[model samples]
Target: MNIKFKNFIWGVITLSVISSCDISDNKDVNPADSFLRIYDSHQFDHEIRPVDVTQTADNGYLFLGNYRRDDVDFLGTYISSVDEEGHFIRNTYLRDNNVHPVGKFLVLGGEHYFISMDAVSLQAYLNQVDDSARVVSTIGIGTTYPMYAENDGEDQFVLLSYSSVNRTTVLSLVNADGSITSQSAFGIGAGQEVEEPIIDHFTRTGRELPFFAGRSVDGTYYANGFYNYTLSLLFTDLSDNTPSGVIQGQLDQGGISSLLSLSGDNYAVARFNYGDQYANAIATLNTSGISSSTDIEGNPMLEWAYDEKVKMTTMTLGNADYIIIATTTKNQQIALHFYDNTGAYIAVDYLGFSSPYQLGAIQVTSDNGLAILGSTQVAGKFQRLCLFKKSESELNDLVQ
Candidate 1:
């Protein structure tokens, strides 16, 4: 029996299928202008929603998504490896009825890491794959709240975890041998929990915290209500066993959708309405002093036509100057916008996709291009993976 749920929301059925046309058959056709469509009907039995994609060192692409065999039960997360020509090398599946791998997959060296967080505790696991899609390692970190993982270098990784039980944040450096050297409660805040911590960029001197935007260098943290529209910042000197300061503010009347840092000093936050209409602003902060606050202008970039329910995802590519903002509308259409270092709007591009599809994750590659993963519908089933790339010139043209 097919179970119809809200998760299976269907949109308009329209597919802009681009294909490679044969020059011999049509002399006017340009081979360079050809776009390829690679989809196998037999391989994809049900819906295959792409969660994330990454380019390997060998120039191949790794795609991660969920595979649903039925409307109700047989749902599992899948990872597939495709070559430069989009030829499927191998595919693997992780079947779990309880938790779904909804986040993006991080590929470093030859291993892939993904965060799986559901209603309970957040967990991080390292995935080992053979010639086929076989998971050989599922090493678990027990009860790490708000677990997030990023590649450090080589085969090493850094896992940032927040402990709600202790109200502290822990940074664990993991080696290839699965041994961990941990620094517990590095920041300055006790009785206060740390939210999201990402390795923004590596400096010549050392690694710096790019995720510190809208946060305090003195150990203050800021976040909105999980399901509300309130925004607040709390200060803590968790490094020492001492109490710090707390600052709170309601930056948005609607709801906070996303937050990102510009370089090391400036930051941007997105706010939207509940009805999925367009509305957002970019808030900047200066961290030159011990205590920091939003600029006098409030949100520098405000949009009335921007969809409120549309969640904005951000990524800083190459240098800190180039920031990419990608968002998907309630209609499941994906749009990309680029901003300069000064938080000025630069350019925007639209990736064409049919209905019943939505954008999932965006990642900047080593070459400064983007890897987008999302889901599409095929034969009335709502699970298909799509990947796209835009050159630097194409991105710059959007701003012009």
Candidate 2:
């Protein structure tokens, strides 16, 4: 971590996300229990936004995001940490020429890991970061462009990447040391397609396409990405790279915007098409051994309609589990939707009203509080990072 104070301007701002946990401080507390902080940059004429956030064991927070410089040809990754009170601790630039950090962080056994790409070699690199926002080690995984990642629900992690040369979507079970234990490729068979959009992203031409790779409850690998040129969800047999079931989608119409796996096989899939949003409260794999669903509408959490940016995740409190869904509402504020494990609506809260805000990332703090990472347009043009923190009591009340 290199000390780079000439990068951003740190200040205070407000934000929120769709996540939660449980706790006792559900009572009155001092104003210090909650606050908002914003970080901006005048150091460089570029865009800085957060991608992932994690509450450290020491009750602090570590954030990872892309640092795009206007003059640079490629993107860089940044690591920032904050104390339990939301005070800044460290902000460092993890720079490597021509290397671009990919999507979300994969946390395993208390360690954080994310994939990056060597723009020249097209090789994917895995970076292991400590809780203190230090890059412990970085090793090359393969010549693949990483898209997304998640824990395997066991002890290791799984990575979803794309191979433009092969025109395929590659799934790999990644070991902690950046080793590929098992890998498979899709999009070579019938009705399988994982192509552009992903390639368009790293090329600085298209949006960051989201792809999920993990196993359902039965240990069957489930993934959702651009299948057949349309955003679709699929269940693949890693042994064969064959998709047994799929969810259909109109070409380029839409797919997963936000997702949270609930009990059993249910997944909360928030969707979007050309900027329109839909709330698919609860969804499951396409059964019949092999089939597809035109829609994931078993239990609707909210009235499906054109909405704002959406994100969701689960939080545990004592013996109960809560599902939190955060969205950029049409009203220009962040809506934190509270729900039970059963998909029942619990409550709703709002954050950020003075100016428009966009959610960057969100998660439950170690103390059952909430930490929301977002960005505000400062001076109507500068994209700055903003965060909102809530106390344990405030979190419980939302779930109640």
Candidate 3:
């Protein structure tokens, strides 16, 4: 394992230690002031799997995840606010009368907020939270599943919604105050031949896909997912839900977890090949069409080389893009691989544990640091949230 060290003062550290009575008893697993902070379930026998994180107005971070309490099968939304140095500011759990799994969060009016849904009521809500992890305002948006939501530049948000009953996808415009401005559904007539990219891709004989859409830097929205279990990508104008171009991969039974818009016309996507037992890949999408991913050495992946399932994430620093892939090997060791924008390898770091650990999410903090969150069994018999961070200087050394 290539471990790099940077200057970190120890005197200013204020740690939040978890008690064994509530969660696990093992407390001797500290990482010697390397900027790696792990938070166990100190409050109760529960698990918190973070799904997304955003940089706060004070240059700190707000993490959102799924919180599973003890003796309960339902999972609630969890939020944690931390200082710029990765110190805990506040932690809280948000739940409704039904199942609520938060997908991601965005910053509006210099405040952190997110949209989530309830499984039973099937209604979606926008929650505006304060610095102390308390909800100050709430706005209700009726029954529609948010596939993706992100800032649309001027204190507004653009999101994609999927309607299962009509099997239609809609692009919605939301104001900063959490009100629906307008929604444009994918306007395709039944049995009417349309010459759009997404329409052509989906109209082919295949299984119904839980369609997803993402916006590019220039505000162009594209939809990508499995069409007949094959990878299909398309660009939509969003004016009338009409697609412009389309591309499809030959790989079967694979799905994308996330889509990241790169600096310019290029984009990256994280893929999981269920046909090969959770084997994963990182591919590039552009006007040149789809390109298969390779390692830093340019070697093709026959399988998850580590014999464990892998999850990948992409982020940018300056004008350069990077990817962080977390792999759980056969020995139950959780590891992370760093790569540059071209899919070339950079460096690798190991979490060094003999328990099952699943990667939940990754984020690049405002201070150029890295925040990694996952679920690990090392804390006890069941999984507990494992959160860690590395300083900006140390992260720079990895790619250098």
- How well does each candidate superpose onto the true structure, as a TM-score? 0.61, 0.83, 0.70
**For this target, which candidate reaches the highest TM-score against the unseen true structure?**
2
RMSD values for the candidates in order, in angstroms, are 10.1, 6.2, 8.7
Give model 2's TM-score versus the native structure: 0.83
| Lowest-sum lDDT 10-residue window in model 2 | 15-24
Cα lDDT, model 2, residue 296: 61
What is the C-alpha lDDT profile of model 2 across 1-400, one tens digit per residue? Answer: 1111223334443221211122225454543367776665533354677677777778777877777755445677777777776656777676565356755677777777777777567778888778667788878876477777778854567788777667767788887777788877767323333454565666656665556667766676766666566666666667776667666555555666666666566777776655556565566645325444445663333433342446787887556787888866664567787777767777888887567777767787766778888776665666667778877777776665
Error of 3 at 132 (Å): 1.8
lDDT string, candidate 1, 1-400, tens digits: 1211112112244332322223335466432222223333234455666556766666566776666544322235577776644445667655553234434354556666654433233454545544334566665654353233555566665555545555444555566555675333433233212222221111112211212112333323333221111222332323442224322233222334455543343345554433332222345443223222222243323332343222344544434455566666545566676766566677676665444445666756554555566655655553566655443434444555
lDDT (tens digit, per residue) of candidate 3 on 140-226: 775465555667765877766555445455667788676777565553233222223333322223332324555687667666543
Clash pairs, candidate 3, are 296-345
lDDT of 2: 0.66
lDDT of 1 at 191: 22
- lDDT ranking from best candidate downward: 2, 3, 1
**Local error of candidate 3 at 70, Å?**
10
